[model samples]
Target chain A: GESVGLHLPTLSVQEGDNSIINCAYSNSASDYFIWYKQESGKGPQFIIDIRSNMDKRQGQRVTVLLNKTVKHLSLQIAATQPGDSAVYFCAEKDAGNMLTFGGGTRLMVKP
Target chain B: DAGITQSPRYKITETGRQVTLMCHQTWSHSYMFWYRQDLGHGLRLIYYSAAADITDKGEVPDGYVVSRSKTENFPLTLESATRSQTSVYFCASAVKETQYFGPGTRLLVL
Candidate 1:
């Protein structure tokens, strides 16, 4: 069984500032990790993903860092905006192709 | 391109009532998954289908049923709905390692 959890339940950030959301997983065999942004009244949308072999992967405005040693994962948003206000979730995929998601962290962007 | 879609974006049902949520994907992907999203639980897998006529139980499959008669459609059914089953249901299809999700169906069991 895999256990994915977020360090913070809610994160408040100022507009134009950077935001960081952290996640921890219990499974050491997890090889793939993904970040999803879920808006109110919508399903979780894919943000970014990083493989266990790589420590970091960058997207347009988001970056995902995976630390296998500590079983830690983090999503960093650059120049956060109001649109970035959403619940962010981290999920780890097992060898069987099943994904286990974390509790999620609500990101609030304050203007 | 309507990659994926779920029917009855919002549904309200009563306890012991039968309800079904429909999911369709245009990508023709081989894998389809059903998940329920609840507060403090993020998303939990309910059921998944590897291909047409091939289904498997996921993390949580109690009180739920799924069938894939065609590659383009997968429907989740609750034989007898319960309040605890009230949550946003999501459908996704995988392309290699990445999975693309549908808009989701919000189910409320009264």
Candidate 2:
């Protein structure tokens, strides 16, 4: 079965430093990819997304990079903060509009 | 305005009992999705509806049933609940690229 996976289950970063979370997907047919941040006791929130055609897309303080050649995806957060700590998940949507999600990476910010 | 709301934020039921999770959205989005989140499995889609009266099975839909009689409502029903069905279920709606998620319903089957 095709699945999306992350390299690390948990990542700890300094509050002022930058953070990067990596994900790998198996299905090449997936054309759209999105990054979501899920806070405790809340639902997942959309952060940013990147299409298969583009390599990267930037948001306010977050950026999503998609490497189609390796079926890799990454989320970069600049100037990480305590509130930014949460479970991050990468999702891929094929042409059918069906989305497959990764296991999720827990981001912990150290003060 | 409430973007999306799920009823019975938490539920507990015994095996063989039936349970239904309600999802409602006010955005009038064309697409609605139901996903279950477990420890090992992050989020697996159970079902989705592209529009009213148009629903399709997703990755994990064997023990679940869904119906979208109206565009604003998409409910998931477990005819005979099992212990394995215990998990956090989230309802989401997508306009085009971005998806908005509801708070989620926590179900515990014993």
Candidate 3:
């Protein structure tokens, strides 16, 4: 069975530093990928998304990098803040709009 | 404007009891999905509907049923609840590009 998985289950980073979270997907047929930030007690919020046709996409303070060759995806956050702490998940949309999500990574920011 | 909403933001029911979670969207999106979120399992799809009266099972669909008689409403029902069924359930709608998620309903079975 194809699955999307993350390399780190939890990450602790200091404020003002950059944080990088990695994810690996098993399905090559997946054409679209998205990154979501889930706050405590809330649903996942869309951060940014990148298509397989592109290698990278950047948003306000976040960036998503897709390495299709290695079947890898990564999310980068700049100048991490306390409010930036939350569980992050990566989702892949195949032929259908049904999204398969990866086990989230808990991002903890240290003051 | 109510983009997407779920009824009974929080629910507590007993085992063997039946509970239903309601989802409503105003976007008239063509795709709607139900997902469960738990520790270690980020978000597993339980069921999804491509259009009215068109439904299909997802990764985890056992012990659950869904009906989409209208494009704006997609409700998930638990025939007989169990402890293993306790988790936060989310309802989402996709407008062809990206999926928009509702707040979610937290269910607890004792």
Candidate 4:
């Protein structure tokens, strides 16, 4: 089965620095994409989402970029904080409204 | 009081035992979903219900059964529990576009 994957399993960055998480998806028909952040001992929390028609979308401190041609998605965090340390996953919505998630990337922020 | 909740925050059971996880949401969201999270992997959907009595299988729906008797409750039952079924289970409800997740239930099967 084709699945989404992360470019790196783990990422480390200094607090207050910028961080980027990359994901590659194999499904072409996917129309919706979402980014979720999961802390230890908790469920995944929605961060940001984008549709196929849009190329970029931004939230308070998070930005989601989508490239359908290359089947790539990325989440950029500005001024990464200590609370930002968590596992990040990129999920794509298939034709049947089912979401397929990537392996996830764990982010570590060092003070 | 208006968020999703999962009962039995933590549980341990022996293999071949039947265990059921309960999920409840205060919001009258029409869509409810069940997902399991494992180490080194993202959350995978087991089952989702569009409405009451309208349920469908998801990517990894084997060894699990789900029923939506009411709009706010979606329960997942493991008919024959296995060690491999040990994972953190999360329930989510979607009213519009984004889905809100619960705290999650941790199950350990020996």
Candidate 5:
């Protein structure tokens, strides 16, 4: 079975610093990857996504890097702020359009 | 009101009881999904509907049933709820490649 997993359960970063969250996936056939952010009680929000053909995709303050060789995915936040505190999840979509989600990493932005 | 919405944001029911969680999406998207989120498990798909009257089971479909009578609504029913079924349930609607989730419904079975 294919699985998506996070390397860290919790990551604490000081304000105005760069925060990186890593994810590893087992399905090499996965072509589409997405990054989601979930607040304390809100639903997961789309952050950024990268296709297997693209090595990196950038959003406003976030960048998603995908390494198909190692089946590794990462989300990088520049100038992390308190508002960026949330649980980040990485998901991979297969050919059937089914998405496998990771356990999620809790990001705490300390002031 | 424009995006996906789930009813009974919080529910508490006992074992052997039947409970239904309603999901409504105004976008008229063809893809709708139900998922459960637990402490250790991030989010496991329960069921999904591609269109009206077109439904399929997902990763964790046991003890759950779903119906799609209309394109805008997808409801998940627990015929006989169990303690293990207690978790935060989320409803999502997808476009081409992006999925938008609703504020989940927290269910607790005692």
Candidate 6:
């Protein structure tokens, strides 16, 4: 069994500011991690991902950092905009199984 | 109209009634998953299919059943709906590592 938890359930950032959302997982066997953003009335959309062997991966204005040693994963969003206000989730993929997502953190960008 | 699409964007049902949520993808991905999101929390996988006719249970599969007869379609069924089953159900498809999700189906069980 694996448990993924978010350090912050909610985060607020001013427009143009950067936002960081953190996630902690309990599975040491997990080899893949991903970050997803879910807007209101929409499903989670892939943001970025990092493999166990890699520590970081960047996509657009988002960067995902994977700390396998600490079982920690974080998603950093640069130049936060009002459109970036959404819920972010970090998921861990075990071996070849489906992903298990964390509780999720709500990111709010104030204009 | 492309990628993934969920049917009946919103649904309402009574307890003990049976309801089915449909999910379809045009990506022809190898994996299709069903997940339920409650409140503002993260999604909990309900079931997933690795390929046609090959399915497996996920984190929360109780009272929920799923079937994937084709590579593009995965349907979730709640034999007897309960209030606790009310949530937004999302269907996703993955080819390799990354997954893509459909809009989602909002289900309410009275």
lDDT of 3 by residue, A14-81 (tens): 99999999999999999999999999999888899999999999998899999999999999999999
Which prediction has the highest TM-score against the true structure? 5
Each candidate structure's TM-score, on Cα atoms with residue i matched to residue i, is 0.96, 0.96, 0.96, 0.94, 0.98, 0.95
With a 3 Å backbone cut-off (N, CA, C), the pairs that clash in candidate 5 are none
Model 2 stretches astray by more than 4 angstroms? none
- TM-score quality measure for candidate 5: 0.98
Cα lDDT tens digits, model 2, A1-111, are 478999999999999999999999999999999999999989999899888999999999898888989999999999999999999999998876777889999999999
lDDT of 5 by residue, B1-110 (tens): 66999999999999999999999999999999999999987899999988899999998999999999999999999999999999999999987667899999999999
What are the per-residue Cα lDDT tens digits for candidate 6 across B1-110? 59999998999999999999999999899899998888655688889899999999988899998888899999999999999999999999999978999999999999
lDDT string for model 4 (B8-110, tens) is 8999999999999999999999999999988766678899999999999887899999999899999999999999999999999997557889999999999
Error of 5 at A87 (Å): 0.6
Query: Model 4: runs farther than 4 Å from truth?
Result: none
lDDT of every model, 2 decimals: 0.93, 0.93, 0.94, 0.92, 0.94, 0.90
Per-residue lDDT tens digits of candidate 3, residues B1-110? 99999988999999999999999999999999999988877788999999999999999999999999999999999999999999999999998858889999999999
DockQ leaderboard ranking = 5, 2, 1, 3, 6, 4
Worst 10 residues of 4 chain B by lDDT: B37-46
Q: Candidate 4 chain A, which ten residues in sequence have the lowest lDDT sum?
A: A92-101
> For every candidate, what is the interface RMSD in angstroms?
1.1, 1.0, 1.1, 1.7, 0.8, 1.7
* Weakest 10 consecutive residues of candidate 6 chain A by summed lDDT: A95-104
Q: 4 or 6: which has the higher lDDT? A: 4
Candidate 2 chain A: 10-residue stretch with minimal lDDT:
A92-101
Error of 3 at B93 (Å): 0.8
Sliding window of 10 residues with minimal summed lDDT for model 1 chain A: A93-102
Q: What is candidate 3's fraction of native contacts?
A: 0.60
How accurate locally is residue B106 in candidate 2, as Cα lDDT from 0 to 100? 95
